[model samples]
Target: MSFRQGAPWPIPPTATGKVQMKNGYHQVKYTWPAAGWRYEARWHERTPWARLITYPSWRLDRTRPGKGYGPDAAPRLTETWVGDHWLPVSRLRYAAARYNHGCATSTDIELLKAAHPAAKQKKLPGK
Candidate 1:
């Protein structure tokens, strides 16, 4: 549950890096194999190779329609302080009520419970 000293952190591979199923996370290498050396590069950050840092390292095909994500779409990050690295959370094809941080957000007014107060606290309307 903690970072191992002396041992290097598990740096995820950018899109243009090679791939292979190791432990649980995908592994990446900077260079490709010379011939039939076994390892092969899969996904990279963006098209071509520019050696630039990108967020939320992508793998071969592990990504799914996890919330906020689908096949071949941009990834959604959860934790903060990862401006440079977008740590993937999960995928969400669709949501019933998603919290919005923008002014363009809206919600179902019908789901509102106590437009009025009850005895002690307002009772939510039964679905």
Candidate 2:
């Protein structure tokens, strides 16, 4: 767990714990990294958007199946959760556009669930 006392508007997923925003508010966040899925949750002093977020393997990687490329060239899952919606984000540009929009990646859903109980119910859109 990390702390950003006076960070900018968009906080990086890597920074966890209590984040001090410019608006004089604190956002509590937790992230989990996994091999097949990633889960994250963030909440603030005031009402916030969907506090629960999740990502699947396909959305995590940009490399089209059979197309092996450098790590930087590969498409990565969006770390930020900008809106209230869950997953099934199809637009490549949409996912790429949001910077610092997600939390840490987690390989263990069970561990993630411990932090954010709601995570269990917020499954991958179609699954």
Candidate 3:
């Protein structure tokens, strides 16, 4: 899709950016240079908001057993947008995973899968 300069992108409050493609249905361009993270969320108008971005991110719940940290804790699973697929990026506790690039709920994962059926499934390092 072509980019339409100055057009507003449909970015959730958690994200920040404007659309860079005019021919695209719905695209959200996000970039955090200092954080070394850049990704895009594209969805059709009929799709739900949660499924807009076909990416799986670490469930953002701080109340989890270990909050995704410490030893013997739950795995830290985040999403990576690879072309038309969203692949899971898992980091075991004590594995030094970044939380900012993660989701906060399982519902988001389900929704993302619905949007991108070809998404890659990944398990924790040893789980």
Tens digit per residue, CA lDDT, model 1, 62-109? 222224545756443332112233222222111112322222223222
What TM-scores do the predictions have? 0.14, 0.29, 0.23
Summed backbone clashes in each candidate are 12, 13, 4
Decreasing TM-score order of the candidates:
2, 3, 1
The ten-residue window of minimal lDDT in model 1 covers 112-121
| Whole-model lDDT per candidate | 0.25, 0.34, 0.34
lDDT of 3 by residue, 100-125 (tens): 24633554444444434331222112
Q: Write the per-residue lDDT of candidate 2 for residues 1-127, one digit (tens) a residue.
A: 2222222223445633433353643444544454444544454443233333332111111112232476645444443322323333343233333322553334222223232222222222233
- Kindly report which residue stretches of model 1 are placed more than 4 angstroms away from their true locations once superposed: 1-17, 32-127
TM-score of 3: 0.23
